[model samples]
Target: AQSVAQPEDQVNVAEGNPLTVKCTYSVSGNPYLFWYVQYPNRGLQFLLKYITGDNLVKGSYGFEAEFNKSQTSFHLKKPSALVSDSALYFCAAVDNYGQNFVFGPGTRLSVLP
Candidate 1:
C-alpha cells in the first residue's frame, strides 16, 4: 500500500517571502511523487513530478520539491510567495505496482500582502 501525507493543513506566508509545504510518503518500492495545485472549483493542475533523477526537481511557477529517499519525503518550495499563489496544494504518490495515485490531504496556502 502506498500513501501520501501533508503534515500541515494550512500554510500562511507574506508576499515576497519564501514558502514551503511539507509532504511525506510510504510505498513498497521506488516512489513516484507528484505535486498539484487546485483553485476554487477547478481541476487540479500538475505542478511537478519526481520520476527519477536528481534529488531536487523543479516545477511550474517557480516551484520546486526535494525528494529524500531515506526519509520518504518530498517537500514543495517556492522562492517567493505571491498573493495570487494562494491555493490548495496536494502531494500524491503512485503505487509501485498499481497504477492508482493516492493523494494527501491538501494544504491550503494563504499569502497575505
Candidate 2:
C-alpha cells in the first residue's frame, strides 16, 4: 500500500539552469518522505525530508522539494543546476510505523556545460 514512481529514467539540463526530478507516492497512512542522491558507488546522501507540515522543504546542496497532498507528490527542485550536480536522484517514502520503505528506480541527471 506504500510505493513511489518516477516516470522518467533521466533528465538533461544545462549548467547554471534549474533542474527537477519527478516523484509521486502512495501510502495507507501519513508518510515520512526523503530524497537521496548517490554519486557513482558513493553512499546515499540525504537531501531532504517531509514529515509533517509545510509542503515545501529545503535540504542539502541547494536542493528543495514541494510536498503536494492533493497530488500525492513530492518533487525535488533546484534553482541553478551545476554540471557537478549531475548524479542519480532517488525518492523514498516510509510508513508511519516504519514498516516499509520504497524507492524509485532512479533518475540520472546530466548537466551540460
Provide the overall lDDT of each model, using Cα atoms, as 2-decimal numbers: 0.94, 0.93
For residues 1-113, write the lDDT of model 1, one tens digit per residue: 56799999999999999999999998878889999999999999999999988999999999999999989999999999999999999999996675778999999999999
Off by over 4 Å in 2: none
Q: Give the deviation of candidate 1 from the true structure as CA RMSD.
A: 1.0
What's the lDDT for residue 95 in model 2?
82
Model 2's alpha-carbon lDDT is 0.93
The candidate scoring highest on TM-score is 2
Name the lDDT of candidate 1.
Answer: 0.94
C-alpha positional error of residue 110 in candidate 1 after TM-score superposition, expressed in Å: 0.4
At residue 58, candidate 2 shows an lDDT of 97
lDDT of 2 by residue, 30-66 (tens): 8899999999989999999999999999999999999
Work out the TM-score per prediction.
0.96, 0.96
**How does model 2 score by TM-score?**
0.96
How many clashes show up per model? 0, 0
- Report lDDT (Cα) of residue 21, candidate 1: 98
